[model samples]
Target: MFQSTAPQRRSIPHGRRRAALWAAVVPLLVAAPIALTGEAQAATPGTSVSYATTCTPGVVPAIHGTTISEITVDNATPKVGDTVNVTYDVTQPASGNPTSTALPANVILPTGVVSLGGAQTGTVTVSGTRTNPPVPGNAPFPAFQMTGSFVVSNPGAITLSPGNYNINSNYIISLDTPCTIDTPPAGVSNTITASPATVPNNRVITDSPSSGPAGTKVAISGSGFTAGATVTVAGFSGTTATSDVTQATADASGNLTATLTVNAAATTGIIAFEGATYTPATASPPVAYSVTAVVPPGGSSQTLNSSVKGGTLSMTQAGSTVTMTPVDFGTGGSSTGALNAITVKDFRGGSSGWSLTASNTNFTGPGGSSLPAAGLSWTPSCTTTAGSPSTCAAGSAGAVGTAGATLASAPAATLTGGQFAAGANLSLTVPAFTAPGSYSSTLTLTLA
Candidate 1:
């Protein structure tokens, strides 16, 4: 050791000097965190901070590094009066963590401001729980996710900044953690663009019955109106409208129903009706109704007559019932008989004449025994009492089978209308083994 100093110098105490140095730096350190949060008052819209500090115990609390919180909105473009949701997440740092674990950590967030056009009006209230996992004694603080909501009152670019929050330790005590946002880095913030409010379309439900006479009561109904508001009903003729001034209140479901009387002096034309309100300045869609002029008192009866003219080619029979002369076969042989005269009057007025056909069902007798309709044969004779250019010809001789035969027919160029009479000579053959009994069959005559 070289002891070359001529005078001995007094040394200052290391503990006192260190204490003085710490006293100066400690105040600056405390004030630095506060200044960062206080910048929120003069912060630009949409700017947020990345660091935060806990003020729990109102005294010494852990100050965390950056990567503190992130805010997100459910709707970025919300219309006026629309409710929007916000989420604030408290992220854990990479290294720092508490030594002890607090079970069931419930985060209670604070209320923030909604800034629009540089003027803050609406408030956002955040709340919810975010618990930590059951780790051992040494464990990092768990992340927290808090939620909140606010209604968009005005339209424009809007900004949101999260406020201070607290942790409810074990559901027993509250711990304040003020994580106020400061001047933000570029493009890091919670921002949204609000759109103008939209209006609903007017709905006019019904006006019953398409047409009605004047002074008639018409039921009108509509929907989509202010609740418990009076509506004015009116009738519009062309561009001019006459108000019925019928007062009707809207129900809880925003539906309105009212009765409107057509004007007594209304003309016979199409008219429109509407239900309207003034407070919100809304009107329902126009419902069209046809209004008929009122008829005079004694004008009910009007003499009317119609000329009855024959339309289609048709025929009518004179008699209701007829009986053919019966022929008996003594020992089961063929017998011939004359058929009753069939008189038909054709009142058809067209040159296209018609043909008359005849058919017969099987003759069923006692004990369900039957004879085939083909067992009978006929020779038809027809005559028409019509004018010239109209002629009726008798059908060809053939067996009267179930399929029927043409009894009489007039050609297309024949008479337009006439009285026609037909007669047939029928011959029936019976087998020797046939039972002896009387049988009847239905003979159908069709004119087409």
Candidate 2:
């Protein structure tokens, strides 16, 4: 069985608190699509609208014209159930009486249609301060931008058209100013595509030979991890506190493979293997492995001495002692070479495991000028011989300094006694200020 955790909501930026308040209101208006009315009259700088206002509760509302432009959606890629900010530019034409003033505004957004079929509706709330001239004059209101937040209810194309916007006022008394839009500006509405929500922490980890004796080799695999991320494989005994852990890097396909052997000290119990990232935010379902103890022969109450023959364990390389391309850094500060295919044969029958390591000497130039051994780095890789049951793994990439580095390895249980082919992309770095001359270095590979 698999379990999933809830995804956390995205945090909004500071100073955009108005959008947050509208998020709570947009979801409630997701019923049938609301149809808009009226036809295009005369096109304005933005969207033209006729405004009817009342500065006093008992007085008749005044009339004016305004345009709304610069409609924008903050999120380029919105997802269903996500809260996004939609902003608009409004410019009021000179008109309201000497005591009229604009107040906080609220608007219903145009119905949105999902590409996959379905309609979504929402609203916007303007929370910015609404006080500027005309408290008593004939000047046009300054152009300003208003922003509101809305929850994306569906996936697909969402077009925001001109809608009913209400502007309140406080001119010695509370008043309401309702505005009606006649038509939307040509190609002025912003369209945003909302995608389907993604599943959170979805991953699967599995292993072969789930039930085995101590020293049994198991091949473990994981998928749905972040690409190029390191994945940790952990094992815990069901009946004991004993545990083990190993790591492998996920490939471009977000898949990982590793080999682990049941610990020798492990007692008969279930060994659960789980895969997770470095942060370990989430883990895949445990792949249970049963451990069975090896039984000894029983006899009639008598003591007997017995000896078991140990098998041979060793590594042998085919062809030359080492296979590397000759490097010629012709007038160069840096260059690269390749470590040709060099197969290492591990005939160690049921042995714990083996590691192939490499180190290098400093490149010696004419007259003995030298480049640091650390300048030589490599991206190591390895593959099991064809038809081989062995699962060979490449070690992490690193420089081949005097201290050396593991180039490749195979876990104890992963190999049924076979050959491992190893190679690497070699890079050589030389200081720019170094004297121009031919340099040479020796690389040594060892199996342990």
Candidate 3:
């Protein structure tokens, strides 16, 4: 009877609702077993998963919070002309054995970011391990760690768009977990210089009195010369003349002057002036002057008689002597004979008066000597055929007079003829009472 009452009309919808609930609950229950199993599996020691990932294309990965770090390059973000670098590290948890392995790193660039040239790239590895092994082998427990890295170079960041760029590196690491990456700040550098040479001034030299008489003054002039400049002249003969004779300092205007007396005996030669050192044919050319010495004419001396007979008389009987002497006409006249008169005799005709004449009155001598008579003569009449008064002709003898009457005492004379008698007769004779007055004559003497 109790069982029959139990069936007291339960609603089908409630049963259905219960059934759906059971269904849902049963699956949850089933899933619980699997979840627990998985959790247990995860909790077991030595559980691990491969750690590696490709880096963003064309970008370099940065490092953070870990001791070990590394970078690598791969195809993930690969671009025809792009390069990238990545770094990885670990944080917390230590590992007994640490190892680093290569990981995929990639580089990529926008069409305009990279040029057609090949991209520059590099790679690196990082690793760290705990000092002690965990327990001994069963399975070496790894310290908390991380791996893999990527390097990427974005051409967009290059100085010029579509220009080649470089990817620094990629990295892989062990013994460090939860690693982060950071990009290092970029570095820049640069350099500079200068240019040129030197400059100089011009020089000039001049000389005065381009030409003059020997022993003349010569002045050396220099213009546009340097200060403390040295000057020289060549072709100098005496001590007064020298190869480097003159020297001077330039004035404010770079002008200089030097005065010197040229040697009177100097021969014609080139006069050269120069700087500290001889510079032949320089702008300041050397100057020279033609010099000449004046020479005077030589002189001679002669003697003549005061009187003689006839138009001409024998030089032998003229009672006149001649001597030769050398003289320097340049200086005025000079004589070396004592004053005296020579005598001449004429044997001409009646009580007629006769005149005596001589030629060349002045004479000079280094020593006393009788001068030569140019001529001796006497005129028969006071007047000559030409109606002119008779006069002694050159190199001729003239009138005769009484001996001693026309003669004067001879002073001491040193004859170049060696010597003469102390009382040598220097007398002439004429007709008695012939005109009576004294007649004068000239004589000339020459010496070697």
Candidate 4:
């Protein structure tokens, strides 16, 4: 470095300095545009911090000539297990070229509903022409159309809200069968009636019997009697007698008959006939009949005679004497005398055993004269000294006596008459009887 004494430099003014700096920086600033262009070319458009924006109409633009119309789903009534066809039509919008747009893929169905196969989702083409014509040259927008169907397994009315929903939405479509829980027809009733109106008394009618005989043929005639009708007979004591009777279907006349046989030994009582109609109709009233048994030969009559007068005889034997007495036995006593008795003949005369003797017994007057105490005796045989022959002897002579007698040390004997209402119990007691077997005698109780 040469050290030289420079003349005192005059200070440069600020404005002149600034002008000189600008003159030098002018070319650099001028080259900035070229550098920015190069950098811009190296980077992608998206990386830029600044961008431009514009607004477009929210609604789809209208197409000329082609029109857009709102779509509607009509309410439908469907039967169970039946399919219903639903149709929706779209009209293209005017003022803009119609473009092909696919319909939404899914539609919500009501609860308890299922869609039939096929026709689900996608675009369908609808051709249309521009009225005013597109602004020269550009291709006309394509139009779209679509169709679908569904079925209702249950019957009902379903409403759809105006909005998008997932599958199986708010309400469901259903079909109901006739007569089911939901669907029912109007005006139906049931009734039942008997045929012939009245059954004959004492006649063996098929179902109605007054007194059924063992082989009696009865005809039970009634209305509402059909092939499946059941018939039964009930007795007065609630005893039920069943029979597999013949059943006839009603013709145009609405009458039927069933034949039945009455059982033998059935009590004489009321006969009741009952019938039941199934499923389709109600049952009928039970018919009844009064019955009686046929009379047999020699059977006692139910009537009584006013003029008959009854009398009775009682007898007892003591030691060697037999006594008889007369008394009133009433109506029952007279009936007892009517019974027949079998006599046992004695091959060996026995005077000691027992006896009914005519000579020993005596009758008083009128009513007593008819008493049967004669020509009967029970005697024992006596041994002869030679033992060659045996002799039989009557042990007692007769005397009038009371109906009962007793021995000093004999077991008590009881004689009881058959059961009788009122009056007296016909009884006898005998004393000193020497028989181990039963000894009985028949006496005539007179009905004067």
The lDDT leader among the candidates is 1
Q: All candidates: CA RMSD in angstroms?
A: 44.2, 23.8, 65.5, 60.1
**lDDT (10s digit) by residue, model 3, range 1-448:** 0001111111101000010111100000000000000000000011121222222222223222222211221222233232222212222212211123322323111110111112323322322222222233212222322222223343222111111111122233212222212332111110001111111223444457655666667777666555555544443321123332445556767677777566545533323334534432222423444555455569544433243222211111122322212223343221112212222221221111222222131111122211111112222211122322222222222322111011111111111011111111222222222222222333221100
lDDT of 4 by residue, 1-448 (tens): 0011122111111100010111000000000000000000000011101111111112333222322222222112233443222322223222221223221222212111111212222211222111222222123222222223344333333322111111111112321111011111111111111122211121122354544445565566655333443433332221233332233344454445655454545322222222432111222323333334556788854533233121111122211111222223321111111111112112211111112222111111232121112222222122222321222232232221112111111011121111111111122222222222222232221100
lDDT of all predictions: 0.50, 0.49, 0.25, 0.23
Candidate 1 similarity to native, TM-score: 0.32
Angstrom error at residue 264, model 4? 3.7
Over 3-48, each residue of candidate 2 has an lDDT whose tens digit, in order, gives: 1112212211100001111010000000011111100010112234
TM-score of each: 0.32, 0.33, 0.21, 0.19
Residue 376 lDDT (model 4): 24
Higher-ranked by lDDT: 2 or 4 = 2
Q: What does the lDDT read for residue 174 in candidate 2?
A: 54
Give residue 100's error in model 2 in angstroms.
9.0
**Which candidate has the highest TM-score of all?**
2
What lDDT, from 0 to 1, does candidate 4 have?
A: 0.23
Candidate 3: worst-modelled 10 consecutive residues by lDDT: 31-40
Angstrom error of the Cα, residue 407, model 4: value is 77
lDDT assessment of candidate 2: 0.49
lDDT of 1 at 132: 53
